[model samples]
Target: MTKEFLLECERKLAKSYVCTALGRDDDSIAITKEIAKDIAFEVTNSIHPISMETAPYVVAALRTLANGIEKEMNPLDKEIARALQELMGRFQFVKEEVKVDL
Candidate 1:
C-alpha cells in the first residue's frame, strides 16, 4: 500500500513538477517520494479544507521535518527539501486563489 502511494506521488510529481533533475539522484528521488507520500496522506486524511492561512503553517511543519532529515548530511535530501518548499509555495498560491473565489 505504501509502495502504491509512493508510485502515485512519483507520477504526480513528474506530471506536475517536471522534476527532471531528480532523475540522476536516487536518494533525491527517494526523498521526494517520501515527501510526496506524506503530502498525499495528509490530503487524504484531512477533513477540513486547506486554507491559504493554514498553508504556511503546513509548510512550516514540513520544513521542520525536512530540517530534521537534512541532519543526515545527504545532498540529495536537500534537493528534495527544496522541491518540497517549492511545492508548498505553489500550494499557498492556489489556496489563496480558492479562498478568494469562495
Candidate 2:
C-alpha cells in the first residue's frame, strides 16, 4: 500500500500501545479509540493514486503487542483485555478494508 496509508495504519495501531499500558476503565478505552480513529482518518486521507502490494503490518504487530500486554497487564484487569480486544477488532477491520482495496 501507499506509504501514507501504511503510516496512518501504524499511527492508529500505536494507540493500542497507549491503551494497553493504561489502567483498566471505559475512559481509557474511549480515549484510545478516539485517538486511533482520528489517526486512521488522517492516514487514509494522505493516500494517493498508487498501486500497493504489501499489506499493512501495523495491526498485526499491535495484535501481538496487545497479546503480550494482556498477559502482563494484570490478569485481574479484565477491562484492559476487553479494551484491547475492541481495539484489535477495529484494527483488523481496517486492515481488511485496506487489503480489499489493494
Candidate 3:
C-alpha cells in the first residue's frame, strides 16, 4: 500500500511539473525551475555519502532539462534562465559544504 501510495504521488508530481513547465508566464517558469532546484537539494542532502543512486539521476535530469530549455528560450526566458543558474550556483555552494563535511 505504501509503495502504491508513493507511485501515485510521483505520478501526480510529474503531471504538476509538466503543467508548470507549460505555464504562460516567465515568472511561472522560473518558479517551476526554482521548485525543482529545491527538490534536488533536498534529495541530495538526504542521501548518505556512500549511496550514489539518486543524486546522479537528479543532476542529470536538471542538466538535460536546462539544456533543452536554453535552446528554446526567448529573451524574457533568458533572464529567467539566468536567475535559475544563479540560484543553482548558490545551491552548489551549500552542496560543497556537505561534501566537505562528509
Candidate 4:
C-alpha cells in the first residue's frame, strides 16, 4: 500500500478505537466495518505486508470492544463480532504457518 492508503487506514482504525472505547456502539460498528473493508482491500490487492506482530494487539482490541458491547448487542452486532473473531483465527493460522515455514 502507498503511504497515503496506510495513513487513511490508521486514521479509520484510530477513529474506531476511540468510538469503541467511549461506548459509541453504532459509530464503533460502522468504523469497524470500514476497517474490515481496509483489511479486505489489503488482502485482495496484496500491496502491503501483513504484520504478524500486530495480530495480538488487534485481537485484544477486538475482544475488549466485543466485551464492552456484549450487553447491548443486537443480532447484527453479534454477527460482526463473529466475523472479527474469525479474522483473528485466520491471523493465528497465518502466524503458525509462518512459524512452520521458518
Candidate 5:
C-alpha cells in the first residue's frame, strides 16, 4: 500500500540525486535500494521521529505536500495533481459510532 509509494519515491530520488550527501551516502546514487530508501524515509517524515516503521508519517507528509501543491499557485501540475487527488480521495476516514444522552 503506502510502502509502494515510498519505494517509488526512493527510486525517483535515486535517479534524480546527482550529487548529495546524507549519512554514509554521497555523490551520485547509482545504487537505488538502501541509500535512496533511507533518504525517502528520513526526508518524507514530518511529525514522527525518523525510523524504519514510519510509513504512516511518510504517507501523511506526502499527502500534506500534495495538498499544498494542488492548492498553491493554481497548480502548475494539473495532471499529476489530479492523479494524486483521485488516488487519495478513494480512501475516506471512518468515524466511530457513538451514543450520547443529553
Candidate 6:
C-alpha cells in the first residue's frame, strides 16, 4: 500500500478508537468495516516497516477498540475486535536492548 493509503487507514482506525471509547459501538463497527481490508492486509515490520513509528499507535487503537466494547456480544463488534487483535500481531513490536554498565 502507498504511504497515503496506510495513513488513511490509521486515521480511520483512530476515529474508530474514539468511537469505541465513547461507547459508540455501532459507529465504531462501521468505521472498522470500512478499513477491514487494510487491517487484514499482510503488514509486517520487515515488509511494511511501520513497527517503529505507526505500530504502537495502531496497536493502542486496536486495544482500545477491543477493550471498549460492551460485555454482551455484538456479533459485528466481536468480529471486528477479533480481526483487529489479529492485525495487532502483524505489526512486529520493536524491542530495544538496554545496556547497563554498573
* Candidate models: Cα lDDT each: 0.60, 0.57, 0.61, 0.68, 0.52, 0.68
Q: How big is the positional error of residue 82 in model 1, measured in Å on the Cα after superposition? A: 1.5
Which residue segments of model 4 deviate by more than 4 Å?
A: 47-102
Candidates arranged by TM-score, highest first: 4, 6, 1, 3, 2, 5
For model 2, the stretches where C-alpha displacement exceeds 4 angstroms are: 1-24, 48-102
What lDDT tens digits, residue by residue, belong to model 3 across residues 2-80? 5665565466557656766677456555545656565555655554353345568767876897689798989997996
Candidate 4, residue 11: the lDDT equals: 95
* TM-scores for the candidates: 0.36, 0.31, 0.35, 0.42, 0.27, 0.39
Cα lDDT, model 4, residue 68: 86
Clashing pairs in 1: none
Clashing pairs in 5: none
Residues 46-67, model 5: lDDT tens digits: 3344344555666688789757
Select the stronger candidate by TM-score from 1 and 5.
1
User: What tens digits encode model 2's per-residue C-alpha lDDT throughout 1-102?
Assistant: 468766766675566566667754565556567665665556445442223443345446556865886777765676855755567556632323333342
Question: Candidate 5, which segments miss by more than 4 Å at Cα?
Answer: 1-52, 83-102
Rank by lDDT (best first): 6, 4, 3, 1, 2, 5
How well does model 4 score by local distance difference test? 0.68
Off by over 4 Å in 6: 38-102
Which of 1 and 6 is the better model by lDDT? 6
lDDT computed for candidate 1: 0.60
lDDT of 2 at 72: 76
Model 1 poorest 10 in a row by lDDT: 89-98
Q: Which residue pairs in model 6 clash with each other?
A: none
